[model samples]
Structure formats: structure tokens, C-alpha cells
Target: MSGATGTGTTMREAFVATAGHLLDEDPRVAVVLAAISADVFADAARRHPDRVIDVGIREQLLVGVAGGMALTGMRPIAHTYAPFLVERPFEQVKLDLGHQGVGAVLVSVGASYDWAAGGRTHHAPGDVALLDTLPGWTVHVPGHPDEVVDLLRRAARTDDRVYLRLTNDGNARAHPVGAGFQVLRTGRRAVVVAVGPVLDRVLAATARLDVTVLYASTVRPFDAVGLRAAVLAADRADVVLVEPYLAGTSTHAVAEALADVPHRVRALGVRRDVELRGYGEPADHDAAHGLDVAGIAARIHAFTRA
Candidate 1:
């Protein structure tokens, strides 16, 4: 329940450590890791060899094994980089998990450009978008280590299919888990929904504007009910969705949520039009995608003014 700020723990570290603890605490818990992040669970594998498994560099086998384990009544927590986790074995995820109706907690790190130096092979800006194609996947984008811990635990306990996304980028603070958006700042001009790590940037962007800022750790299952309430409270249809993935990933959901009412929405996130070959750091990619605080502020100002 406590935030991991200044605790010298990264979100990836928290995920691995917490998963190991789950393996020790719960007999039903099984962790399947690719060679990419196997080091994080080294101790867990040593302790629970039967429950903790490493499939080497095989991404398809990673997801297939997890799906098979889930079918046998084990709570499988699969971890790997974003591209390998979701992109490489997407069909396995779609058929093994989705087609079979089995559930597993798919936890991923190196979100989008976290490994910008590693090039496009390491980046996965479309991970969430791809998952969105499937049905009944609970997608969680945790902004802080605390949120990661909480969301991971929640996923482990459920029989529902879940995806916990972790990244190097994070917000300054963490909020409690709940349905819909948690209103951080109340305003009437517009409603800005910041998904996961983007909360900090969105807050900075709209600091001077009289707009409601809502933060969400759980994005899939879109929280249309919560969004409608915020928009109605603001008495305006100006909705700004700042996701951490591809732009407009959730635009359809937002539009559907406000279908009965008159509304104007602007979806912001990483751009998919072109590949950003100038990879250096996450900040560099963020700037290129116009997800930095300055860029977000400019977009918000223009949208609100119009």
C-alpha cells in the first residue's frame, strides 16, 4: 500500500520481487519469465523451481507455457520486455489465452521507448493497442512502483486475463485503486484524463488551466462511467485523453462514452505515423512524440481555447 518513492526500487524490480513473494506465499502462483528479465527472479527460480520457469529467449513458448499453466489452474505471471512479451508471441496470446478462455497475468517492462538506445527492436508503442484487439484483457498501466505492486497483486488474485505494464517513467505520486478516473484537480473548463505515468506530465501541462485532471491506472474496460461523470461535472464536452501508448488508442472508447452528449476530444500519446530513428533516451523519444510537458501544455491550451 505504501508508495516506493525513494525506496531505491524500480517498477521492474518491484514486479520481479513481488512476483517472487507471491510464489513463496501462494502455491497457485507460477512465474514464467523469458531470458530478458530472468535475473530479477533468480532467487525465486532457485527457491521454487517447479513454479518459476525461464523459457530462454523463446517468446512464443513463453506465452504458450503460461497459457498452458493457466489452463491447469495455476496463476501464471509472465514477464519480459514489451516487444517480446506482446509483439513476438501475439498469436499465442490471442489463441492460447484468448481463444482458450484461460487467464494469466501478463506483466511487461521496457514500455514503448524505455530502451530507446536499444532501437526499434526494443520499443513497443503498440503493445497496448494490440492487446486492445482482444476481448476481456484487463490492461493496467501503473505510474508508480506502489501502483505496480497493488495492480500486480490484484491481477494475481483474479481469474480474469490481466496485463500489468511497467516503465522507467513514472509520476511523482501514487493513487489508490478504483474504478474510473481519480480526479486529481477539479476544474470546469475541461477534463484531462492522464493514464498511468503520463499523470505527472499532464499535471504540469494543465497547471495554469481550470480543467479537471483525472488519473487512471486501469485503462482497459475504459471507465466510460467515470469519464462521463467528470465531463458532466465540468459541464463541458472538452475531453483530453493522455495515454502512454499510441495516440487515439482509447479515442473510440471516449467517443462511445460520450455518444449521447456533444463533446470534443483530443487524444495524445506516442505518434505512429513515422518511426523515430533518433533514439537516445526516453526523454528524447517523448519529445519527438510531443508527449513532453511543454508539448502537452501547448496542445491543452489550444484545445481549451478553441
Candidate 2:
């Protein structure tokens, strides 16, 4: 099992370790599952049977139970694949937790096309966009296992509704987890905002270019102030957002942030126009969606030249 330190651990391992630690250290912490990562929690469940709940294949009930637990003053951590956790049980998430105004941490894996072999049934490129319709949610897309551990711990301690989107992909290095964007590189031409695991590819794509690169794990609460600051620091109010989920997911946020400043933005991410049916690997999906280093660089170069 991985520890809270998070070094050399997968994002899933970090989540399990952090959640287990929360259960051990906090009495209010409870874990609700829909059969995802159940075996990992066997020991924790044995120790705190009352708090660890597995609701079998019922995705709706999985969220309902967590909401019910939250109603009773318990903080619940709900787990499952992205499509099942966010898209399948959305109504439950909307009413049980959102409408009722209770808090629960929902952790999801198999981001976007991580399990490409599972096909469209397993993909969730619109999870963040769906969540955007709701109010008062803290959405985290961690690029590293360390960030996952950090964000999960932060979410558990609070009563806010949190979505910790973990993934099979990760960055080479972990940036400091903070409320706003962490500025990695600065330039005056344009601002390139890389969300989550796409940071590495974005850095590589823009290595020889003159652009400011900002890394964001926390996309919600959209960090308008930070984005504005970065944009204003640049010579041109041009922004390029590269997200891990649906393309243009955060474009509206960027527009709103740069409103009244006469800025331009180009958003890049998983395509929403057509469903990509074939996939050999995660990189294959990335290339198909123009999220690979070359794809990203080409788009950014064009935007900068324009």
C-alpha cells in the first residue's frame, strides 16, 4: 500500500492511501463504493465496517448511500469509474448531494479514454462540463499521485462537494497544489493554461516558444483572478487552454475571466464533435484528439502566429 508521502505511487494508490488515512485519523470520514477498488479497502473496511460500504453494481445507490451518510453528519468518499461515478449516477449527484446541500467527496478513475479498450461506455469527456451546471463544487484534476494525495486530503477535511478526478496518466513532476494557477513559465506573447496531466505535453509543445505556461489542478472555482493576472502580464491578451477532458470545457471560464479585456482564446481537449471509435492505447487517443505534443504545438504555433 502507498503512504501519504505519495512518491513512486500511482494516482489510484495515492487516493486509497489518503482515504484510508482519513478513515484512521478522522471519525467523520466514511467510504462508499460501487465495487471499484473494493479489495484495496478490505482491511480498512474490516477495521471500520460501519463506515466502509460497498453497494455492489448499483451506481445510483452508491451515490444515494453517500448522500444519506452525509445527511447524518458523516463525510463520505464515493468511488467508481468516471462514467459510472459522474455520468451514470448524475441525478443522484444532482439531487441527493447537490440539491440537499450536503457534502461528499466523489473520486473517479479511468479518465476520458484511459480505458480505451472498454470503448465509449467507459469514456467520460463531458464529466466536468456536466458538473459545471451545478453550483458549489470543487473539481480537481490532479496531474500526479502526490497532487492526488494532497487534493484528496484537502477535500476530506472540508464539507464542500469535491470531485477528485484521478487518472492512469500523470506528469513527470508534481507542482505545488494551491487555490489558484501555479505559474510555471512566463512570457508576454500568450498564456497557455495546462490543466492536470496535460501539463507535461503542454510544456514540451511550448518549450521553444515564447509563452507563459500556467498549471492548474483545481479548475473549478475557475481561478479568474490568477488567469487575469497572467493575461495582463502578457503583451497580448491571448489564451490557450489545454484540458484533459472535453475540448472547450473551460473556454467559457476563460472568456468570462478575460471579459472586458478584449482577449482571444483557443481551447484544446478531447473532441465533442464526433465519438472516436478506435483506440490502441492512451497515446493513440491523445493523438486522435490532437492532445499529443506535436498536435498541441501545431495548434499553439498557429494561434501565436495569428
lDDT by residue (tens digit), candidate 2, 1-306: 121234468899888988899999999999999888999999999989999999999999999999999999999999999999999999999999999999999999999988889998898999999999999999999998889978998998899999999898888878889789999999988999999999989999999999999999999989999999999999999999999999999999998987899999999999878888786788899999999999999999999999
- Candidate 2 lands at a TM-score of 0.97
Which residue ranges in model 1 land beyond 4 Å of their true spot? 1-4
Off by over 4 Å in 2: 1-7
Which residue pairs clash in candidate 1?
none
lDDT tens digits, residue span 231-305, model 1: 999867899989989999999999999999899999899997989888788888888888999999999999999
For each candidate in the order shown, give its overall lDDT on alpha carbons: 0.89, 0.92
Worst 10 residues of 1 by lDDT: 1-10
- Please give the range of 10 consecutive residues that has the lowest summed lDDT in model 2: 1-10
What's every prediction's RMSD, in angstroms? 1.9, 2.2
